[model samples]
Target chain A: MLNIKDLHVKLEEEDKVILKGVDLDVPAGAVHAIMGPNGSGKSTLSYVLSGRDGYEVTAGAATLDGADLLVLDPEERASAGLFLAFQYPVEIPGVGNMTFLRTALNAQKKARGEDEVSAGDFLKLIREKAKSLKIDADMLKRPVNVGFSGGEKKRNEILQMAMLEPKMCILDETDSGLDVDAMRLVSEGVNALRDAGRSFLVITHYQRLLDHIKPDVVHIMANGRIVKTGGPELALEVENNGYADILEEVA
Target chain B: MGLPADKSDATADRLAALTMPDGASWARIAREAASTRFQAMGLPGRRDEYWRFTQPDTLNAIQPPEAALYPPEDPPAFSALDRLSVVFRDGIFDPEASDDLALEGLEIERLSTATQADFHWAKDLYGVLETRGQDPVERPFAALNTAFATDGVVLRATKKILKPIHFRYLHEKTDSDAILHFVVRVEEGAELTLLEGGPAAARFNKCMEIDVADRGSFHHIRAQGRDHERRAVTHLFARLGEESTFKSFTLTANGRLTRNEAVIELTGDNATAHIAGAAVGDGDFHHDDTVFVTHDAVNCESRQVFKKVLKNGAVGAFQGKILVKEGAQKTDGYQISQSLLLDEDAQFLAKPELEIYADDVICSHGSTTGAIDEEALFYLRSRGVSASEAQDLLVLAFLAEAIEEIESEEIADDILTRLESWLVRHRG
Candidate 1:
């Protein structure tokens, strides 16, 4: 459902290259994970795909279901069913979490020319989703992630993913700051949203997250390129021996 | 051979040209004293310390651009509240449109109808609070308002009133110039809530003096209307007794020039006062808020929260101070003024000062002016909210801090609706 070909990106303000000749493809209904050591351009790829500013796409083409994703604004891309779960969720003070969700939902509806959900229906829907994520009413009543713990913030992101129901989901280091319990709850939430028509690109440094939400394929990235691609066992291999053998094999 | 340069005071020349209203009421002596005080002080000059950030030209002009009273479209603010309404058209009290002047345990009398034989509760209050508020600095317009204002209301609350008193000022004359003065007294253990709304005239000068006795409570909410060519200069003087509570919130939409100054004195121990303003401005809009609070009694608390949103070269200014006397121990005072500039041309100037002479007191003040948070903006936009929608959300969030100071939820909601509609109109 998502495709990229020879994507080259560099920092806009500085003469620094982040991604050099990277290419990947995630087919419909498939789950893929990208694992690499530090500074391997995994998060950079996610940000460039999400149309974040401060990045110059030197050479590349990215399309979602054959529709040009780079041409659309971030919000337009969101309406076109591209979702990126941020690694560090922003803290917005004085904006209630529920209000934010409602505004977002109605905004998307207006863009899609669909009937907006009533307040009562929205309350019920949010409550149902929040209960599954173990979020209480107080969390929804407070400002969006203002003082939320790291785990709470991650869980909130998963809750947003559940509510948006995008066709393709990109999770950037969702397991970075999570503990064992939080990781399991988050993986369970992701697993609950698994469907035959949906796809996920899980980017992480550890193999523990893949244990819960098992990926159909695993790719090893190093020096701005996906150097190795294999079945799920590649993740366990990297987890066991690290990226030493993989880098040497690619070399 | 050089010609002599003109040395006449520009400030005095501006005030001398305007004629004072004719009055021979019981406040004649107070009026004369204030007239003399104004003559000495004259109009505020551009070089004045308090008027440094904001120019005093538009406010000092003898003839304001005649603003044709725009047709009223929206319902008056606080219409849903159960209130006793008093209407004013072009600064003149309209007896027919107003409600029956009656309230339980409260006395309401018009200054025009008050008789000399039966001097209302305002006899001592005509200019007493204004005179007391004048200290190191002079407010000549407030003195001028005292000297010439002929139409207003005197309110006295003996007990807890069931409903609030609403004063709706309507503009119907293009060249209307109004000077309004209002006095209110809340007795011991009594409660009062006052609400004022409207764009009164092209050039409006208003003063409200409030005195709350021990253990009394007073809540005020004002909504300054949108009139692009209108210029207004207003003053609020309040004194709180022991254990009293006072909170005032103002919502300013838009105007050519507006300067709202507030002076509050905490006279008795354990009294609390809060003053807040939330303003929105577009092109050709200039809004200023100046507040001074004095903690004269021990264990008193005062807070000032002001927020402004300026766009398209609009200007906003704030000058606020908190002073704690030597014996006012354990005083807790907090003040914060913030502004959101939508673009590079918009300007916000703030001066926050704290003067504490007490050995043990907690007084803190802060001021900030900045654009909307980029990270927060992107966060919302990434969630499918449009760019303008995200901006509106952030603007509202920025204003929520000051809007929360309103004591009534319903009134706050009404103001929020008005702000939303205003944003929609300006987005065009």
Candidate 2:
């Protein structure tokens, strides 16, 4: 569902290369996990794929469902079935959570030439989704992420992912701020959305999250390139021994 | 001290073009007093401390600069509400378009006719609050409005009023210059809501003086008209009694120049006053809000909130002050002024002040001018919102605090709808 070919990205404001000759592919219905140390270009990969500003894709290409994603605007990419669950959800002071969700859903629908959802139907759907995520009505009514706890923010992100139902989902460090209970809840939410037509690229540092989501494959990333690709046991291998041995062997 | 030569000359030139309307002996006396005060202070100049951020040239000129009239496209504001409509066309009362001048729990009349009576309730408040507001700082334009206003409404509420009174000013002539003064008295235990909208003229000057008796309440919501070339200067002076409450909110969009000044005095213990405004401006637009609140009695509270959205080199300015007099213990005052600049060329200038003579008081003021948050923008766009739609949402969010000051949800929604349309129309 998602493909990257020799992806090279550099910071726009300075002369520094963050992602150098990185390539990865996640087929439909499969979950792939990428484990890397800090500053290893894990988050940069997600940002570049999502078409965020301040980054120049110098040399390679990324595509979702066989459509070029690099040339699309961030919103256009969203309409083309790409979603990124941010590591840190932004706190918008006055935009209500429900309103934001509805606007985003309708915008994507309009861009894709689909019928816009009515307010009543949208409300019903959101209430049902929020119930499973344990997000009460008050949280939905409040300003987006304002004064929300870390768990609540992650849950909110999952709620959005569920609502949008994109084809290729990028979870960039979604487990960074979660406790054990929060991680369980978030993983449950993600696991429930797994289907044959959807794909996920789970980016994390630890194997704890992989235990709940059960990735189909694991790739150990080092210095912006995938140094190793293995099964679920690779996550446990890194957990027990750490990245030092893997880095030495790869070198 | 004698007025400066240039100031006196400018004031005289402007006054020479206006003729005060005839009225009763008391009204004449009040106008004469105001005229004397105006001559002493003269028209504000750039050298004045309060006018430093905003140029007073067009506002002080002898002949108003001609403005091209904008075609009215949207329905008039507050049209959905059941109200007592008072319509004015180019400063003159349009009796044909206005409803009957009668309502329960209130006495209302035209200022031109009301002041002609030898004895009237409006006599006590015609220029009383404006004159009292002149001390410590001079507002010569308000004095000028009192001396030479053409026409307006006079209202006195003796009981709780269920329906609001709507003042709809329609601009039809390009060179029409208008000056209007309104006097309001809310008696003890009474309440009233006043709604105003539309572009009055090419150049407009308005003054409203309100005196709220003990336990009385007054609410004001005004939308300055969407005339791209219009110029207006307005003043609101209010005095509150014990346990009285006063709240006023304004929405301004699309004007060449506008200066809205509010002076409020909490004269009795436990009184509360709040003044707020939201303004949106595009190219060639300049909006200013100057506010002053004085706490004279113990435990009085006052709040001032103002927000502006400017783009395409538009300019916005705010000058707000809160003063707690000696013996006014436990005074609580809060003031905040903020502006969102959409482009590098747009500018926001603010001055916030607090003066406390009483030691036991909580007073705080803040002012900020910033651009849109890029991270927030990216977040919204990544979720499928277009760049323009995301910006409009953020702009509305920035102005939400001031819009929330309106007590009525229905009215606030109306203002929000108007703001949304303004954003869509002004989209780059």
Candidate 3:
């Protein structure tokens, strides 16, 4: 469902290369985990795929279901079924969480030429979805991510993902600041959205999160490229040993 | 010392175009005193400290600058509320269009009729607060309005008012120069809400004096008219008694020049006051908010919050000060003024000051001018909101703090709706 081939990106303001050459493919219904060390361009990859500014695509292409994701604006990419759960969700003061969600949902619907959801239906739907993530009425009423705990921010992201129901999801370090309980809650929320037509590319530094939401495939990314691809045991190997061993072996 | 020759000449020329209306002996005395005060101060010159940021040439002109009437397609602001509507057409009191000037727990009278009476309660306050506010800083325009204004309303609340009083001004004449004065008194333990709206005239000068007695409360919400060519200068002077509450909020959109000045004095202990405004200006729009709050009693609190959204060469200015007197211990004062410049050409000038003679008071002030938060903007757009819609949301969020100062949720919502429309119309 998602494809990237020889994606080379550099900082737009400077001539520093971030992703030299990267290639990845996550088929429909597959959960792919990308494990990488710090400064290995994992977050940069996620940002580039989501159409963030300050990044210049020097070479190659990325697509979703054969649609050129590189050419579309961020919102258009979203309407094209691309969702990126930010590593750190923005704290937007004065914008209620519920209102943000509703505006986003309606905006995507309008962009896709679909009828907008009624307010009542939206409230009901959000309540049901948010309950599964343990988000209460007060959290929904408050400003988006303002004063939210790290775990709540992550869960809010998952709630957004579930509401958007994108065809492809990219979770960039979702387990970074979460506790064990919060990690489990967030993993469960993500697992609930797994279906035949959906795909996920989970980017992380640790293997513990994979225990909650099992991945179909694992890729060890290093030096701006995915050098190794294997089964879940690859993650176990890295967890027990380390990326040092893999890097040395690959070299 | 005498005034500068040019300043005196300008003030004289402006006053030459106005003929003071005849009134009772007391009213006549008050008008003459105000005129004397105004002449001494003279029209604010460009070199004046307070007028440096905004030019007063048009405001001091003899003839009112002509402004084409912009009859709003939408219904007037606060029209949905159950209110006692008082209408004015081009500065004249339109008795036929206004409701009966009577309500329970309240006494309301037209300024024209009130001044005509030989003995009236308004005579005590018509220009009393304006004269008091002139000290330390001169407000010559307010003095002029007090001296020559022949149209407005006098309101007194004896108890909690169930409905708000709405003053709706309509601009139907291109060169109409309207001067209006309002006097409000809230008795002890009484509560009242005052609502004002409209583009009164091509050039409008307005003055309002409010006295809130001990334990009384007064809420004011005003929406300046949407005439893009209109020029206006307004003054609001208020005195708060012991344990009283005073809150005022203004929402301004689309005017060529608007200067709103408010001076509040907390005289009795434990009183609270809040003043807030949100202005949106696009192209040739210049809006200024000048506020001064003084704390003279112990344990008083005051807050000022102003936000402006300027685009397409619009200019916004804010000058606010908080003064805590020597014996006003434990005073809590906070002030914040911010502007969102949508483009490179939009300008925001702010001056925030705090003068404290009491060492124990806690006063904080801040001013900021910036473009939209790019991170927040991208965050919204990444969630599928279009660029324009996302910017509008951020603009509303930026003004939300000022809008929150409105006590009524319904009114706050109405203000939000108006802001949204303004953003949509001015979207890039």
Candidate 4:
């Protein structure tokens, strides 16, 4: 469902190459996890895939179900079923969470020539989803990410992804600030969204979340390239032994 | 170094004398009082304390006589909605288009012929809460307005009256200067919401005096004209009663030279007041909003927020002062003034002052002036929102803090729509 062949990305206004000759593919109904040490292009890959500005795709191509993803803007990529769980969601004051979510959903629907959701139905759906995510009713009334705790913001990101129901979701360090309970709750929300037609590219450094979601494959990335691919057991090995040994072997 | 001083002085004298109201028993007294104040203050100069932050030269050059007092050539038809409408043409009251507005325990009428009983309450309270003597500057126009002020509106809500009141002050262009004075009194335990619009053509000077009796409440919203050529100064002075609440909002979208002076005095214990204003100026428009709040009783609270958007030689100023008098303990006051300067030629000045003679009071003031954040711009652009659209959203958000306080839903929505359109036009 998602493909990136020999992707090479460079930082804008500089010759520094952050991602070099990386290849990755996730088939339908599959979950993929990428583990890497700091400075190993973990976030750069996500930024490049998400089509964020300031990251130039120096070479290669990225596609979602045979359609070019690199050519689309972030919102277009979002409407095309591509979701990126930001490491730090931006705080947008005065833009209520419910309003922002409804706008995004309606924009996506409008792009696809679908009927717009009524306010009543939208409120109902959001309430149900937010409840399952352990989100308070008042949280949706506040500005997006404004005054939200670190863990609450992460959970809200997943809640948005659940509401969006994207075809391919890239989770980048979503577990960094979650407590034990919040991590389990967030993992459960992500797990409930898993199905035969969805794909996930979970990026993380800890094995704790993987134990809950259980990815189908794990890839080791270093120096902007994926040098190792194995089943879910590789996550445990990397977690116990750390990424230094893997980095040496990959180099 | 500039235009000859005598030429301007002679011009002002001609204009003031030329614009005096027509013959009436009260006209002489009004003119005498007005000329006395005008003579004492002359035209506000740069050296004046209150005129320090404001451009007094432009005001000095203005000497408009009473503008044309005629009906609108083609007045916009009012919709079928059951609203109490009062229309003014060129600063003259028009009874043909106004509603009688007979609500229980409330009276809305033109000030010209109101009986002694009708104005007895206002006459007892008018100018009782004065800021001129407190500030060392002689406000030439305010004094002039007071001296010549006549025949506007007297809206009084009796005790415990809850009905809303709508006031529309429409200003049309005339060849002369126009001035209006409004008096409002909300009696004890009475509540009133006032929606006022200075939708006028250039050449109108408006002043409003309001007082809230013990336990009375008042909410006033005013939108100034949207013409850079029009020159205006609107003074709003309000006094709050015990346990009473007062809130006022002033919006300045366009004007050549406009000033809105709002004063709220919490004279009763546990009284609260909030004063907020927003202005977006373009061309050589100059807009200033000066707010003053005094807490005289214990446990009173006051808040002031002001925002301005300037572009292309436009100038904006915000000078807010909060005072806590002696024995007014436990006073809580917060003030903030911010501006977004869109062009180098555009200038903004924000001055926030606090004077607290009482101990154990919480008061703080903040001011910020800067362009939009580039990082946030990049983020919005990355999301596919065009630069102009993103800016419009941000600017609206910046101004929303003040606009949101408006109590009237219909009027607030109308103002918001107008503001949105203004933002779109100026986004470039």
Clash pairs, model 4 backbone? B19-B65, B19-B66, B34-B147, B65-B176, B65-B177, B66-B177, B67-B176, B67-B177, B171-B200
> If chain B of candidate 1 is superposed on the true chain B, what is its TM-score?
0.95
RMSD of each: 2.6, 0.9, 1.3, 4.1
TM-score of chain B of each: 0.95, 0.99, 0.99, 0.87
Clashing pairs in 2: none
The docking quality of candidate 4, as DockQ, is 0.29
Chain A TM-score by candidate, in order: 0.98, 0.99, 0.99, 0.98
lDDT string for model 3 (A111-168, tens) is 9999999999999999999999999999999999999999999999999999999999
- True contact recovery of candidate 4: 0.15
Q: For residues A52-94, what per-residue lDDT tens digits would candidate 2 score against the true structure?
A: 9999999988999899999999999999999999999999999
For model 2 the local lDDT of residue A26 reads 97
Give stretches of model 3 more than 4 Å off: none
lDDT computed for candidate 1: 0.89
Docking class of 1: high
TM-scores of all candidate predictions against the true structure: 0.96, 0.99, 0.98, 0.88
Q: Candidate 3 at residue B198, lDDT?
A: 91
Q: For residues A81-139, write the lDDT of model 4, one tens digit per residue.
A: 88888887777776678867786777678767789889999999999999999899899
Best candidate per TM-score, number? 2
Alpha-carbon deviation at A159 in model 3, angstroms:
1.1
